[model samples]
Target: MQDAPRTVTFGPKRFCFGRRTYVMGVLNVTRDSFSDGGRYLAFDRAVARAEEMVEEGADIIDVGAESARLEAEKLDPAAELERLLPVIEWIARHLEVAISVDTYKSVVAEAVLQAGAHIINDISGLHEDPEMAGVVARHGAGLVVMHLQGSARQPARQPRYDDVVAEVTAYLQASIQTARQAGVAPDRIMVDPGIGVGKLTEHNLALLRELPRLKALGHPILVGHSRTSVIGNLVDAPIGDRLEGTLGATAALVALGVDVVRVHDVRANVRAARVADAILRGWTPPWPWAFDAVTGEQRRPLRSLRELARQD
Candidate 1:
């Protein structure tokens, strides 16, 4: 485990690791997203969805114009900017939600940010673009840097790691160097371990289990395991049925003191986080959930949503 990073503020939200779990709701502005495809493809619908995520207790809204799922091609800068900027503008003008533009292209970032988005949730870190770090720095925007082990097109398979923890920690340290050297304030950057984008299941699990190891990098850790295939494989379920796995993963991260979780099922995750936060903060249980949601029967371990949402 590593020392926690300094507390940082993103717009009006302030987070210090070990305090509370921050939820980042996914608002895919695309027609082919793997999880919520076409759910928010229209600008008005996307804006409304962003508003609802805020109402659902999401602390941040992650807007993505391209689907980075398997074989998810990168969106060209112009089209991607065209798809995201309007929604960002509407969110910024209407809601107090802190919007995160999910793109690796500096061009798209520049345009959407100019429209008032507050953060850059780039999956490739700064490895994908020459000017991304500078753009973040110039705007003093928040940054989410992730570690990827392969090309843009392939999942990270059999990624070589003499020491996965040490290697990832060092890479993040170096990326922080790149960020600060490019004028990005050291306090404004957050790090994600690239949960599923390029990592295999073992790699993803290792990163999650050893997430405390990442705090040594001196930045908040962002865990995005919600509805990912890694959870599906673990529970033998499809994308829609991995809520329990998602809840378990978020609980584990909260136990490890991770700062944020990027998720799709915000309501369930909000419930789970409430319970986990109570346990971590030494608070009382919210509900005595010794039974199931629909039926009043004693459930098995980790079965009740309210039980899952209350202190153990």
Candidate 2:
């Protein structure tokens, strides 16, 4: 795996990686997102949810107009713009957080970037729409190129991979090359493994277990596994009850040095990332904790060392 990037510029904001993991809150404005569908379909609710996420510690807001579920119906560019433009405009005008629109259509990406969005999270890895790469390049927006075995609009097919990690790495490498050829800068690109999109449970597990291999691509890795079927399969819990499972996954990703995690439960995931970052990334209390700068040990203890030894 390549050394962590020093910094990445997403539109007007700059994010320094290797300090701590960043959380991206998911805001699906569609009525069929498989998890939070219809929850933010209303304009007021969607805007409010974005505000809440920002206050809850989300470094980015990922807005999706169309659902990516295999069984979900397709949404035309016009209809998608109708649902997306207003929200993107509102977030751009009101919110201070970075805005990322989840759409594979060039028309939609163009419109959203014009509407003040900073990033485009394309599930097709710039392969779905012929004009997507150029649009992203023109806007100079941050791009996330995700790997999907089958088309996002196509019906679910059995995913076949002899070596999931090697194949995914190669697929993403090709995507990065495509972006660079289209004039998109390397620092503006991030890669996703497309967990639960076209992969079976075992495939998803393998990707997660071998995520370190993705870092070798020399791009920050972004994983969106919140409340996914993989979590449900592991914990045997329903969508609403997967909070603990999602946090568990977040901690693991933090340990693996993931740069960004796109999640539905922003507050819980942010808190989990904090603890994991503290343990794995050498983070300590910010202030008022009387910690040793060189040793990272607390100078003042709640219980005296003598008392602790007596208990032992």
Candidate 3:
């Protein structure tokens, strides 16, 4: 793994990467998001769902006011702010996890940050609003800069790239530079390769295969592969039925040392990530006690057969 800062502190929390993959539960409060949209549109329902996710092992709660799906109508800044403020306030006051406002508008970003959101997840990579980097900098919030080949408002055309990994890395590098120039701290920035944003299936697959290469950029890598079309297309499954595929992809990414996995099925993904992390990083049992087969007593620490034979 490339050498980078292992921890990112935002607001009152510190995210320790490398020990295990962090799960960022998706909380889209819009009625038109790709999945799980209207389910949490009401403020109370949103807060309740957020609490549910936190209990399910979500390290962060990403609240989105507007759906990022291309066909969804663009939300005005006021409407976006209005939609997000209540949920943001509730999560901020009640939840102990880090809160991220998924928005590209500088006004919404500023408003949510002041309302206790700790991060701004911009799909435009700080390019949509010229003042976005400034807003993030002013609030000293963590920033998730995702790479998209085209504008989020329009349908994404099938993008072509001579070298997809290299191109994505270059774009993120420039975006990070833009953020730094605008005064956002480097350690507080994360890069997402934009899994389903503008890329074709092959492009998304290639990015997944070459994900470890992104570590060269010296920032934490956040991959949002939860229930996206890539998985559905591969398995010929619908969005609502792609949880297994999502868990599969999430496990693969965790094995590759991804710092964070943005997901919808928080509890399932958390279990999957823990297993994958254990396999990749090695795990110790939480409790040492184990039943001894010979004695029928829970008096010995769990040990492999090889260790027992050696003791004999």
Cα lDDT tens digits, model 1, 199-299, are 66777778878887787777888988988879999999998799999999988887788878999988778778878878776545454556787987787
Question: For residues 99-204, what per-residue lDDT tens digits would candidate 3 score against the true structure?
Answer: 9889989999999999999999999898789999999998889999999888867637768899999999999998899999999998899999999888899999
Off by more than 4 A, model 3: 2-5, 283-312
Q: Residue 96 CA error for candidate 3 (Å)?
A: 0.5
Q: Candidate 3 clash total?
A: 0
What is the TM-score of each predicted model, taking all chains together?
A: 0.86, 0.90, 0.90
Q: Candidate 3 deviates by what RMSD?
A: 6.2
The window of 10 residues in a row where model 1 has the poorest summed lDDT is: 303-312
Q: What is the TM-score (0 to 1) of candidate 1?
A: 0.86
Q: Candidate 1: which stretches are off by over 4 Å?
A: 1-6, 153-162, 283-312
Give per-candidate clash totals.
1, 0, 0
Off by over 4 Å in 2: 1-5, 285-312
The model with the greater lDDT, 1 or 3, is 3
